[model samples]
Target: MKWFFKIVVLSILLQSFQCTDTDDNSGAIISAQLETKKQEIQNYINSFSCSESVGCGFIAFGSKPCGGPRSYLLFSNSVDLTKLQAMVKTYNDMDELYNVQTNAVSDCMFVAPPTEVKCMNGICTIIK
Candidate 1:
């Protein structure tokens, strides 16, 4: 009876450790996916070029755990605006979901939007 009790307790402990490891692995996977999505959005933005400040624009990107966008991305009008917006929306949605799943915490500070976007030295950039 004593040996049986010990084996049962050990089994329960091992199962608990395995469950914890699985949770950690899943969280890491989600984080990696978020980074990949962010890179895709950035690569798409960088593929376009700008010649004039008037042609530069900014879009809100990423989701803060507390609420609102984490920051803005500057882009040129030369890119496909519709496609870019859709990609950004998808990224934002993923980020929001990740935050909720991970119980992510932040300072909750409001990130101010850029006052202006400009084409500076052939690159679209925020002027704030």
Candidate 2:
């Protein structure tokens, strides 16, 4: 009887550990996906030509036209405008940012944790 109890306890413990591992992996995947999306957004902003002179950035998520013209959403720790511009060069196919943003707004409806950039119709908000 004691042996049976020990076996059951060990099984429960193993199952619990497995569940925790799965959760950790899932969290990592989600974070990675978000970061990739954020970088893509930054690329779109950098590609555009802001008229006049200004020091501002934008992030957009979701499918609504709520935020200003140039707005974006990020899921990372920092919101460095210069870093965002530099990151845009890493992508081989920048056009994909449109489809990705569209899907993110219409399908995933993901929002950046820090900024208020919303995506709508495959275009992130752009401000002058």
Candidate 3:
């Protein structure tokens, strides 16, 4: 009887530990997703065109305006509206839960949470 009780307790403890491990992994996965999103925003910004006055512009570093959060989506002066629409759709599909804001500067793209769109102006430096 003693041995059996010990075995059962051990099994329960093991199960609890396993559950904690699973939760840890889920957190890590979420972090990775956010990192990937940041990288995508960086790539888009690096190619933004500052020459065009009408298109998107980058905001300087250390200055992020609020709106949820914001992401810049810059493009050339001759951005294809249809293509931009498609890209927006694709991004929305990636994470259905969080709202995505896309700002299009001249040849650049800044992507962030919807609250931070205003910061996506003339600062075209790549965020490291």
Candidate 2 worst ten-residue window by lDDT? 62-71
Residue 84 displacement in candidate 2 (angstroms): 16
> CA lDDT of 22 in candidate 2?
39
Q: Give the C-alpha miss distance for residue 117 in model 1, angstroms.
A: 1.2
lDDT of each: 0.86, 0.43, 0.42
Per-residue lDDT, model 1, residue 5, is 100
Q: How many pairs in model 1 have backbone atoms within 3 A of each other, for residues 3 or more apart or on separate chains, i.e. clashes? A: 0
Error of model 2, residue 62, in angstroms: 8.8
What is the TM-score ranking, best to worst? 1, 3, 2
Off by over 4 Å in 2: 1-29, 53-128
What lDDT is obtained when candidate 2 is compared to the true structure? Answer: 0.43
> Which one wins by TM-score: 1 or 3?
1
Clashing pairs in 1: none
User: Which has the higher TM-score value, candidate number 2 or candidate number 3?
Assistant: 3
Per lDDT, the best of the predicted structures is 1
Best by TM-score: 1
